[model samples]
Target: MEEVYGFEMSDGTGDFFGYTADHLFADIWTRPGLTDRDRRLLLIGMLAGQGAADVLGIQVPAAYANGELDDEALREIVIFVCHYAGWPQGARLNSIVEETIAKAARRAARAGESS
Candidate 1:
């Protein structure tokens, strides 16, 4: 969860969190057939197609932070997904992707300056 979301989670919250940690993250995410990057892309496509901007917001930044996606690829995803997912959802995705890219650039700059 922390690896994908970029934040540490508390331990033993409840059944919901437990199932998420033990089953979703531990089992499903770790399956060997697909790489994390591949899963990320598939997840993004599904989220975009479903018009799930809120969740996509989290995944987009995490994907960028984890080096699974770059600015160009993210933008290209917007175009491709928009064609199939509808223009309105694509607009939402485009906004999220651009925002994520800008935030990532700012973060990198701050890290560079701290060095």
Candidate 2:
């Protein structure tokens, strides 16, 4: 959360951070019902449906980073989402996915160079 938002949750949010950490991240996210990949897929769908590009920008890349999604799978998801979420929403998500993939590749190349 700090890396994504640029500040710790305890940096003045009071109990808000505690609730997020204890409930949202620890309790809900750690539940045994769904795999991390399943959670990522569901979140992507929900965010795309609501036109939440800002959060999607973070999440889509995270999906890639966590191995929950690959390029082809992400493309397929965008195409599938187009039918229910409208073309514009799908297009925007497609753009985000492409950008995320490219950024991940750049990061990987840089990491390899430093090795």
Question: lDDT: which candidate is best?
Answer: 1
lDDT of each: 0.91, 0.83
**Per-residue C-alpha lDDT of model 1 across residues 15-73, encoded as one tens digit per residue:** 89999898999999998999888999999999999999999999999999888899999
Residue 5 of candidate 2: its Cα lDDT?
31
Clashing pairs in 2: none
lDDT of 2 at 84: 88
- Model 2 gets an lDDT of 0.83
**Model 2, range 1-115, lDDT digits (tens) per residue?**
4333333456646687778776877777778999878888899999999999999888888777777789999999999989989999999999999998889799999999999
Off by over 4 Å in 2: 1-12
Candidate 1's error at 100, in angstroms? 0.6
TM-score of each: 0.91, 0.83
Give the TM-score (vs. native) of candidate 2: 0.83
* Model 2 weakest lDDT span, ten residues long: 1-10
